[model samples]
Target: MKLPPWFRRRRVGVAATLVSVAALTAVMAPLQDDIGLLNEGLLLLLLTLVISGTWGREVGIFAAVTSNLALNFFFVEPLHTLTVQSPENVLALFVFLGVSIIGSSLLAAARASAEEARRREAETQVLLSLSRAMIGQTEPAEALASLCREVVAAFDAPGASVLTAAAGGWGVLAHAGSADAGRPADAQERTMAEQAASSGQITRIGHTGLGNSRRPRIVAPSGTQRIREADVGSAFVPLLFGDRTLGVLRLDGPIGATPFAQHPDSLLAAFAGEAALGVQRAELAQAASHADALRQADEMKTALMTSISHDLKTPLAGIKTAVSSLIDTSVEWSDEDREAFLATIDSQADRLNRVISDILDLNRIESGVIAPARRSVHVASLLDDVRERTALVTKPRVVTLDAGADIYAQADETLMAQALVNLIENAAKYSAAGAPIHLAASAAGASVEIVVSDEGPGIAARDLPHVFERFYRAQEGSRRVKGSGLGLAIVKGFVTLSGGSVRVESAPSGTRFVIQLPVAEQAKASA
Candidate 1:
């Protein structure tokens, strides 16, 4: 139970007066003979000043009255009586009382000022700490929860909870302290939260009649009526950000136990404002992250469409032109001319097939569906297969293969041959006309290294890193080379699936592609 304000004030004043009088009495008794009336009066006045500086005006006034009465009864000429012996004693007693009252009043004002300054300092520190804690948080829900815990601790409330307005109703974002003690247990308490959030004002339940105002009664669609302050016991502070009310901060404690209810509404509002800004910052950060991801995906989609369109159009145009020339009877083509045109049609059709196959292979590899079937194969045999398949397109360019006898690699032969074909074709397109393209294999420790070196204009330093990426082509000298840009990407995919590695070295002299495949243990032992 809380005591009435007037009663509590009187009790504190009476207690301070009694203690001050007792201390003066105890000190005056031992020195009464040695200390004259003037010394005794000064001692009692000093005691009153000290008491007044520690307590406030009400207690200070009481101490002055007690000290004046005690001075006359114990230290005046008529000892142990409230009577003065002469005019001089009367003058001395009056002077002592007047000085005591003025000194106590001055000291009391100074004490109240000091107390106020200390209180403001404490409030500022709490606000600073709360701001620091909220600023470092990047998630909305987590930041709100941390804010609630800080508020509860700062205000020394029994319990506190933060509620956010949602589609269904008020949702609890975070709670601190006992669940039963801090949260709304009845519909009336929840109504208070809704009222505060909707009105953007501080709402209180079970408050003393100070600053009480009636709000319009709220009625739910189900016919539930809002309860007045007499029926509930809590305080609700709305968190407002700009023009929007974000939520309500609910505080629960015994009647008159919640410090926030007693504090100025502006202070609580300031705290709510900080929390609202923190939540808004976190929400904006999350939205930016999501938007960035969507932008990257859209860019990838656009690039894929553009690359596929160009790759398909080039081969389709060639095939169409060759077919048109062959079927035109009006032209009266000779046998040799017809044979050359037929070969053009066949080669263009084959190029189209290869383009389609590369697209499918790249998709399969990226989706992790291309599982290689490993086997032991001779390096020389693999090189021959690649040379034969690529000879049709890479004519006039000499392809050489150098490998030791009986040297075998453990890999998927079909995938390995495809990888080699891509490397040889790439080398032929970029190298000098009629330049020799070298395909050499050597045993290095436990692996077989296949090196494809070309006497072509080497790739630029900047484009080397991204050469293995899908749809990436060397921009410096690749304008004349016709390709779908999936050749090296496919080679890298196949080599990786076979448990091998591929890398390239380029300079002004030449470009070298080194592929390392694990050698069969038996073959390595024999070598």
Candidate 2:
């Protein structure tokens, strides 16, 4: 059996110390006549010193008293009696008693101090390890589990658990070791933990009796209770932070076990303090994360309002002005003037339709309704289709495409084509009038790469990372672009859903958007 920590090392029990003294007396009694009286006194004193050094001061004192009486009755002048008959013997006895008691006291005190220092050092190490483990832990359940593991390892207990008060009452947040070890084995343990948390004091529950008669009982503290032998079965330490009792840390040991039979209040406090901090950190992190989410939602709402007010209103105003002019008959208008007015109405109406379409696409993407029907799509044909569709948007600007007839990509052709159209339109809108917009497709390893590049003023370095984020637009020179910032975001969503990835590279001279899609089997086989 493993000895209790207090009894291990150089310490022994009272019963063992007495038995040792008796054994020494038995061996020395028969040699009383052969040994000198003073010499006998010295041998007994030597035994007192040895016992005191090993078994501690209290046991040493008891040993000294017992030995002095034994020496007088068994070997002193007055054999088998308490009376001393010689002056020299009386003086020797007094000196021996004084020396034994004083020497033992000093030696025991020194040993106790050394043990305290070692205990403090070990506790410090445990606290340091626990603090490091808990640092930067944002998840509440994960933090609690880490604390439980640390407690079990530090005490060598059968198990440890952390409990917190939730809406549904007390719940075990996390546990380590034996499943039942941390749970309340009986109602008494539950009561003990409740008492600890309510009072912010350490409480304990203990088991006593034998066989089927064994029962658990509350051993809660009137004040702060340290880990005593009777309180070792289970300990409920309140996790207190400031004025709040955040939770309880329960430590469990097997009945009759000695590994955790004795522990100091300071050591328990250190662990509880760290546990409280971990819980508080997790709570704060959760609050911060929730607050951030709400803030982002508010920002998105504001951006949407701004887009509607500027982009939608601008197109509507142009259409309304052109229609009102066409209906007025007070002036005889030329055919040229009427034609210009009709053209303005048509272009502005198209612009309004495009904006509404972009908004609907963004909604679908965000709502997770964009599921692509994957198929082998010829790259050359997809590029040609996109170029034709965006001819109006890229008017007056030269557009170029480079794709081999054998190149094909695994993607939904309609989604991929729409994604490319957005890129081409975006390039044309930002670049100088007539600046060439180039589209290319090539086989790269196991994927097909589609590139759209423009000799436009490239995106600012600070804006490149967030370009694909919905409702985000980089300022063009001193003014923001007049459109919903959903084009690039839709492009990304569609490409991602089609089993492809998109990225952009920009410099002061130009900008390049690259999309990579899985290469179709036909393309690989044909190559």
Candidate 3:
């Protein structure tokens, strides 16, 4: 038959004590005439101390009583009887009993202290492992999944899941262990979870009758309530960060079996709280990243509008003035004057067209649609074409080119010439009327280098970095000179597309813009 736990626990100690008492009494009974009662009592007392030190206080007490009874019955004056015939023998038996009880109590207390220390150490290790797993996890869902796995392993449960607060209701973020672990909590289960979350408390619902029914109940802090043992399916631990409840950790196993039932409610609740802080931190980081992206986009939009308004108005104003002068009938102009005015109209119209074209080209380049058609092109010939096209703007300003007849680069000829034209135009707009603009090209290693230098006031140091940005005009130079600010930007975009690079160097002496493109295979073979 199955015995109660109390009896079962002491069974081995009881048996051992009984056997020791019987043996000691049997051996000492033959020597009782030679040895005194006090000597026999001392031998029995030593046996009682050994039992108490090994089997704990309850069993120790049982051993002491057994030893005392044996001493009185077998060793005292009334030999083999349950009575002490002499008063001095009675006092000696009582003294042996008292010493055994005192020694057992001390031994039992020491054992309890060691056991408590070991339990605390195990709990500390579990918590440390959990903290390590959660560190550096940026995603909230990923962090929650790690926490669930750690909890399941720590408690030796079948499965564990975390339910986070979602838009409509609770959403399962992560689960570990069994396949069914991640399933959405049922209505009743969710109710229990919500109760724990709302109240910032831990709620356990399972068959609690199997364990200690009368064990000391765990009381929660103010604003929290302790969970009592009840017939339910699982335990709901609320993940709380201060007054805010982030989510709930739902732990469960097979039917009629609660694996986490053995764990203390307070410890599980504390673990859930740490997991909540991790989730909160991850969510905050994500929100911050999103906000930064939005801010940058808004700033870009504002800059685009401001640039478009300023650049578009300059050419439009010129065209409007020229057209208005031509249509005026109040003053009749001579043939020469009419031709000059017509020329002004044509040139201003062309400038407006170029502005619109630059806008379209920039849009295509920024959207990754510009694909250069590269081929071997003579660098001298390309410079000649650009110089001719920019004759109208460079007439007053002297422009000179020094490039070898055979210098060739692998690039889109049309885009390459356009880039050179933009650079020359920018130089002309900034340099004095009589100042010289120098264009030089030569083969350097496997690449051809083209340099456009102008005798103009140097660009400011702070403006150099942003010189190639779209719609970026130099604060110092833009005020004195008129431009759409798209020249340098277009040059950079076209050169980059042709598998080339462009850079600028500005000093007190002058500003130099450099362009480098790979030498063509045919050109290298020819050389």
Candidate 4:
């Protein structure tokens, strides 16, 4: 609880000094003769210094005058009288009074200086805390709310709030304490806040016993620059960055409580500056994030257009040419020639279908719409299915499967087959015409490893890590590897959807793609 201002005034100090002096004289009067007049004056001077240190300068001065009179009466040659008989005693009395007054003033000034240092230290700590909060929180609303709480706690105010200028008018960005505490209690208080924001100055209002005054009363103290003081209550600090005024910080203290008044005006303004900087930084970060998203979207569109113009059109051109050859009337085509043309049409159509499927599958995977239905899948059967589906493409290249009969995995059979087909086809496209593709499956502790390896020229080390990225090509331009580049990305997505992981190892001799799936029995045991 805060004491009334009168309780803290000089009257209380004067009464305390009187009581203290009376007590000292009662104890020291008997020893005055043995201690001598000089000793008595020293003891009285000590008493005056103690009173001054405890009750401040005004009370100390009063104590000094009272002590001088008491020493002349109770301990000087003319005991119990205000008159000092000897010239030496008169000199001693004057010296004692002068020293006590001077000592009290020095002691009081020292105490005030120490108090001001402590207050400044506290203000620095609050500013440091605000800086940390601003840097730590990325969201503007959350950071401002945290700062409001800190302000309310630091000042012991009823509440605090931050208001930002909005389209139509001011909007409360964040507030702490009671719902009504930080908010303007009336139009007059709101106008004061707006005045501070518009003028780029600190505005304070103190409540009189009758009510708040109609106009704000301003005062400047000796030690501070442009420090404004009122009776005691609310303060409105503007948040200014450069020439722009971002918002206002409203501090609401109770009437007769000098929470905001206890700190210097410069410290409050520093807090406002910190809040403005946080607002500007948050806005910049948000703008950067938005720009990044737009750039990614543009890149995706460009890559998709590139793929359509090359991979899709290549097969389409072959199909159209083969159809035109089969229907040509001028030439007498042989039975074998007709059959070859039909085969070309079929192969090109299959290739076109694969490219479209990869595009759609990639879209689904990226959209998080694909959910795998995992179950026990026989390793040998899965490989056999993949081999049959990819036979048309992997024609001249040989595919050899190596797997144990007992090996089984927990996976979605359809997704697993599709992923394997992509890998096998990818290997066939890159390897030598007659090169052998190896498919191997083995039990490795609680998991099963399925590896599709090719004896083709290994991928460049720079391209190895990005092999699973959609639309990435190791070689750019006309000489680049064929296909949409979505095959390996689909392989990784499908495997991961089935609760499995895929990785690759490449060297000068060859490239190997490994997929690890949980063993059927092990998955069941854990579940």
TM-score per candidate, chains pooled: 0.62, 0.69, 0.60, 0.60
Scored by TM-score, the top model is: 2
Instruction: Give RMSD to native, each candidate.
Output: 9.9, 7.5, 10.3, 10.5
Q: Per-residue CA lDDT of candidate 1, range 45-80, in tens?
A: 887887777666667777878888888888776888
Winner on TM-score between 1 and 3 is 1
lDDT values of the candidates?
0.76, 0.79, 0.77, 0.79
Q: Name the lDDT of candidate 2.
A: 0.79
| Backbone-clash count (model 1) | 0
- Encode model 2's per-residue lDDT on 1-527: one tens digit a residue: 33354574344556666687788778888988998678777888888887787778988898789878878888897688999999989998999899989988988898778767767787788778887887777687787788788777777777888777655355677888777754643555556777888877776665321112112235544565643455346767889999998888877754332222344467668888877877787678778989999998888788889876778999889889888888899877899988998899999988899889999988888899877899888899999999999998899888998999989899988889999999998998889887999999999899999999999889999999999987788855715556678899999999998999999999988999999999997754345
Tens digits of per-residue lDDT, candidate 4, 159-181, equal: 77887765656677788876876
Error of 2 at 34 (Å): 8.6
Task: Please state the error at residue 444 of candidate 4 in Å.
Answer: 2.1
